[model samples]
Target: MATIYDVAKQAGVSPKTVSRVLNGDAPVGARTREAVEAAIRALDYRPSSAARTMRSSRSGLVGLITGAISRGDGSAGPSGLPDLFIVQAIQRVVAEAGMTLMIADTGGEADRAVELMATFAQHRAEGLIYVADSHQRIEDLDPRGTPLVLANCFDAAGTPAVLPDDRAGQRALVERVIAAGHRRIAYLTLPEGMIATELRSRGYREALEAAGIAFDPALVIEGFADHGEGPRPYIASALDRLLALEDRPSVICCGNDELALRLYGELRDRGIRVPQEISVAGYDDYRVISETLYPPLTTADLNYRGIGEAAARRLLALIAGAPAPTEAEVIGGPVCWRQSVTEH
Candidate 1:
């Protein structure tokens, strides 16, 4: 609770001198500086960041708004906690640049975003970052002159953004499957409306066309909702249909690690042997599902941390009055080849 006035009084100096010593704004005698430092240590005095911000005309604080809710009772939804990997990466970079990060969660409610934005603006944050749970378009956010950056998402009106290269990531994974000698590859994609669904499906087709394989409509199935109720009945029916085809696919590519996990159980119950009768692969190398399975899964990394780092860099540049990047930053992760995929 010690203030500059207290330090000044204890040091027998004026408050202006104390400010000069603390902020190096002006020259102070060595003896006076030493006296102020001693008083600061003696009283355990902490300079008020707000006061410093007002004097310097910069807050040295960045606000981050996320969709992940932190329940006090320690509960996580089926998708587990929101992707904090990106936030952690952003924090590290921002701290390296001598700025502190202030985070607010939207509790998965989009309506709460405006309130959070207003709070950050009121606090005079140097910039703000809006991070979505996944790659998608975020709308209705008014930056209010505070430099804003989007992480793991984008805005339709062309705001600065950092996102995973969903299409390229999927293309790379499918290319890996093809390299393993799987000619007939089936894909279980995310819901039709999802941004990832469209991008990843495009990648799937691109990879097939690159390999001189004709795209097979029958092998592509839309994924079902993940209600944590084992695998959906529709998924099993879809799998059965794929398996019954005259030229059945030799490998099944899942939308994500979670879907692959559920599919693993469903495939097991049907007496299908992984990598023997059929091969499997997934996206989003979510360790809990990808690494824990009896056979580790082959999947694509989302590179969320990379996204965070890019967003931080972009925000910092914008805060420095640099021109905003014309295109969204697209980061790509490597393919994690594990035991789930087998050579044909």
Candidate 2:
């Protein structure tokens, strides 16, 4: 099958021109159009359904590469809700951008991401979106000249990315919890070196300072899971330690919905009540996890869908030889005011 590349060369025009002639997006001079047409016929080139869809639908094809943590909840791998939302949102956006999307979940394996990326190239994906389960520093990740977009990924290199303005989310959620008259807040985090770990931690410190409360490292706890990843073991241990403290906090801030849900469960087991004994808050508005949790989680709706759509658009522009975005785009979040937190 002769590709558009073959036609472009035969017609003595750039591939962009060949694409324009094929998509009918830009007007070609009659001479150029005739040349492209003659080349197309001479080569007996046939456009794939994906290319035809691009012409009719106004969107080229794109690839989404996600890295999951390979967690075990009796499932195939890692689980993170924020990343999930972002992936889902990207799906919606690509559809709107006149493009079709193919996604590969890396399951917390950078190798998987690399392999999937190679596959994406094989399919000639016009652009690529790299989504991480958390904001971990990616090492040795190369997209090989494809227009790249990172979702919730924090890397100085690679292509432009969409990041959650989590610093803001933390600041807002923490301040709101504090203003409700809750003092002695606790932040139970995941292992260090995770992206959200750093950002949300910053939010925790800033919030405490804003409230004129001295930051206490003692009150901070990290959950190191034993049985499985959720909110159970770590929550039980953190709560045990926090409650055992000479001065227990009246509120607790969790790293994510998964951890928060676990904390909520453990707190209930210990006869500690949410928003009554201790106000609790979390991040990531995972649909099922947040909506179905006992107290219903109060969290940030990081608009993953919007970010995905934006990435799709950016990739298309890149494929069309459009100017790349001048700077990194931060996808912001909305606070989902649920009943998990209570005003003091």
Candidate 3:
């Protein structure tokens, strides 16, 4: 087990310099940083997690409030980010900052989340990162004497939040679909309460309008983000309505790959041909539901990893007693194209 002093000695730098490099407290020259990094790697140096907490009055821990531990559909736990693969990456960032995590499952209930927030405060958590499976409008989260940040949940208050740039992702998707000559495109979404979902829908409509295409409210249909397991029955019923329409859309944009892929089973039951009859597209490139589907879904590769890493960086700032920048910190994303969409 190599110590910081040993690493400092190996790099021929003072222990303070090594600490600065680790904490991101000061700027080290690129060459010096590279040397310090190499010394750490060569010596297999690891920081003392306990040392950080012992030296600081702050807990060296921050709470990640989420509904991740429960099932949706009004179940007793959470179900989103963990399903989307962001939580673990979030943990990695916290660890690098020499901080620990305290996760509280809200069971997807507002009352539970409020209570949990208070409990984390009782534990003297330096700050909080409110994470959701998707974007949600949570009320009264006021930071309660602690600094707060939203992860995967954008803020209307212009507070600090980290979200995958769905606007960029969706705009690119719509542009390609338009370039392919699809004029009548429908964006199927969940309810507008979630920021990410609503933002994606807005992007979809904006893209169409920007191309001189008329926006049709009729083309957008709202469904569910989490049905816990299996497709919601309304999904099939909605597809039936679209398929039965006299002038159906040339392409359908889903809120996510899971919902987009559902079209296979839902439409196939009616013996409809994909791309031939109506092309479908999705968001959030979930591999299983996207790749292995009847036609692999063309969706957005929303950088969940980037979002998690950004969130961890924000949480670290609060933990270190640094003032958070007033400017909204945004870490944006991109798109993933598969075979689900086609030209008119």
Candidate 4:
């Protein structure tokens, strides 16, 4: 195997000069750099990453812990698909920053995170990022002095984090629905007690208040059971409650795209025509559900990719000695206007 000395000898330069050219830590004359490059190509020399790490004390690696890849088999949280989008975006940003990303899958086991962190520490990863499959609170992650960032989740320990702005997303979606002339808007929400559910519900109410529409608790209903109780547990009942109202809603805002898709079926079963009779809106603009629906659902993009990118940037900043943020950074996406929502 060709070594750096072999290339240096071939290029007629000292070993220190070769190291400078390889590391780009010091400037070399253009001609000297060109000669070193030619010698490297001729010798096909490969530098030892271990040696580089020892000299610079930087592994040039970022550790990412996530269950998104393991959940690719479709066993995801209540939101539907795994957070693969977030992971992909993180990978892109880290690569662009000239750092390698080492991913560790927890396989749906939250406890495995600590073990994974230890493994990353063993490798001397410059930073660590934990990405949750959903927006929620994560606890008990001890970074052990290595810079850490949470993506799509936040820790009470005040670790830097990037999370989807659920409240702002829901509020924006509802505001769009209101602009479409929906005064009697019914909201079919996720099960109570979830972080996203609570924030999005508040957003819905805030949007209504901003539009001068009185908030009616009667129009809000749980659209599904928590913890995967059943495939389509409460859709029919929720729809029944809304339809039975003497003053039926002109439009219904679903907690997410999955619920909106299921509600479409229930509404069809009852011979209701979408948009013509009652328009519908959804959240998480999941393309599979939103685009394939009859009229193409109007929804909000959760900006999972943006969240991931922001998380990666934050982690890199922390690695560079930036102070941790006191509050989680929130990312928001635009509302997608489609044919499903019509003027009342």
Candidate 5:
């Protein structure tokens, strides 16, 4: 096996200089760095992670706790799809920052998070991040002095967090719907009591008010059951109510792509032609449904990837002794316009 000494000898540099080049703790001249790098490549020298940690006390490892990977059915919190996009984005950012990510799945049990934190601590992780499958509040997480950040979730404990701006995302999409000349817009909302449900509802109303449209309670209906309550035929029921209204809505905005996909089926059964008889839109921009729909569905991009990138950056900053954010960072994405919505 090639050693640091062998690399130093091959590069015609002192062992201390080689250490500086390898660790990047001290600056090395360009030529010296080039020589060391060349020697490392030629010898295929692999640095010992344990030895590096022993010297700098930084494991160069970030701990991530998420259920994104362990969900056997690939079902996640509201959208019913795994939050793999967020995890994938976090992985990219951590790798680009030259840090190793140690991911631990919660196995769909939130109570296992503390145990996972302990395991990561034993591995000497410099920082930790917890990612939730949906936008909600998570409580009772005690980081035990380790720098910690939350992604796609928040807590009252003031932990630095990065979350999707649900209110803004919904408002933006609705504004675009209105801009396309929609007036009597009906909303098929997620189950009540979820954080996103309330925020997005507020955004929906805000957009309507801004466009000089009166808020019609009858136009809004719950489109799904709360978690743990077996799924009911909420979409069909909601659609029936909307269609029965004295003045039917010209367009319907669904809670998420899953609901929109379901809505598409119900609309088809009712002989409704999307954007011709009635327009349809959704949230979360779950492309499998949105893009593949007969006339690609319009929706909001919740920017889960952006949330992950922000969370990873915030964790890295906290690990570097940066002050925690006074409030959670909120990330928003653009509204995607497709054939589903028409200019009335």
Candidate 6:
């Protein structure tokens, strides 16, 4: 029930001076600011965000559209809301920046993007962030000139985006594998067209080339991309082909922790002992799979939360009239080593 006028009277300052101190729109003397702050605390004053917006013409609200955060039953798919981590991070960052975040879940439907964005515009959101579950391209979105930044996904029209450094992460993991004495390595990758698949594939080859190992076309195999696809046929086929090669790989690198989990079962069913017959590693480090597996799978962290924070920061800058980035901001995370991988 306390108002700015009450705080101003207690602080012995004009309401405008209290407004300046509260909004930080104009400079105030340190002593005056301290007095106003102390008065606000004493009165438990809560400023009207609407009044501030009316005066400053800033809503102090950011909108986020994501398919990864939903209100449905907790079981969306095998991945089970992978982008939720990113959403939480964005929420935290926006709150810390003194802005409110309005989130709209698309329910895994891309066609709802424009509608959600329109709603955000109606609410006068100062900026927007689109968070994707994985690295990919989003098409046919109408921003209506709202400042927008992407998280874990990119827009084809050169929108500023913050994404995981898939290529660098994969290359670093491969480098570590090589350092562990792995010469012939096999890679089971996600489906062909995904951004993570392409980047990680390039990184695989780059690491091999850097280590003076010839790029063997036979070592790479395409695996399931979506969580719903499951990991049977693709992984089994790839494992069969790899096992038949004259120079069979000493280590197998999987696209993500889910795939690595399936690979462990397949290998065990075939009576192959992990790290004794063949070393295994994975990416994304979904702890349930990576840490709980028999040998504890070695993998790389995707850094989705970091990507969310970065996207929120970039969108805030863009809303303030800063130049948008022409290329994606790539954030890198560390590789995790576990008992699944050994000196091969």
Pick by TM-score: 3 or 4, better one: 4
- My TM-score estimates for the predictions, one after another, are 0.88, 0.75, 0.72, 0.89, 0.86, 0.83
Using alpha carbons, what is the TM-score of model 6?
Answer: 0.83
For residue 179, model 1's alpha carbon misses the true position, in angstroms, by 1.0
Segments of candidate 4 deviating more than 4 angstroms: 4-44, 74-77, 226-229
C-alpha lDDT (0 to 100) for residue 133 of candidate 6: 75
- Positional deviation of residue 249's Cα in model 1 after best superposition, in angstroms: 0.8
- Residue 194 CA displacement from its true place in model 6, Å: 1.5
Clashes found in each candidate (C-alpha, N, C closer than 3 A): 0, 11, 5, 0, 0, 0
lDDT by residue for model 4 (166-207), tens:
999999999989887789999988878789999999999999
lDDT of 2 by residue, 120-181 (tens): 88777878888776555566567777787776665656467666777787888888877778
lDDT of the structure predicted as candidate 4 = 0.89
The C-alpha stretches of model 3 lying farther than 4 A from their native spots are: 1-55, 72-84, 122-124, 142-144, 154-159, 192-194, 223-233
**lDDT by residue (tens digit), candidate 1, 163-232:** 8898999999999999999999999887678888889999999999999999999999975555465346
**Cα lDDT of model 6 by residue, 200-248, tens digit:** 9999999999999999989898755444655686678789999999999
Q: Give residue 198's lDDT in candidate 2 (0 to 100).
A: 74
Candidate 3 lDDT for residue 260: 71
Per-residue lDDT for 1-344 in model 3, tens only?
89999999999999999998998878999989988999999998888866765556778778887765664332211112252356677888888877788988777575676678788888778878887676554455666777788877755675578767767778888988998899888877755566666667878878898899998777777755445543558687667667667878888887776677666677787787787888888776666667888677787776677887888788777767878767656666666767777755
Clashing pairs in 6: none
* Alpha carbon RMSD to native, model 3: 8.7
Indicate the residue-level lDDT of 36 in model 3. Answer: 95
Candidate 3 accuracy as TM-score:
0.72
lDDT of each structure? 0.86, 0.74, 0.74, 0.89, 0.88, 0.86
Query: Which of candidates 2 and 6 reaches a greater lDDT?
Result: 6
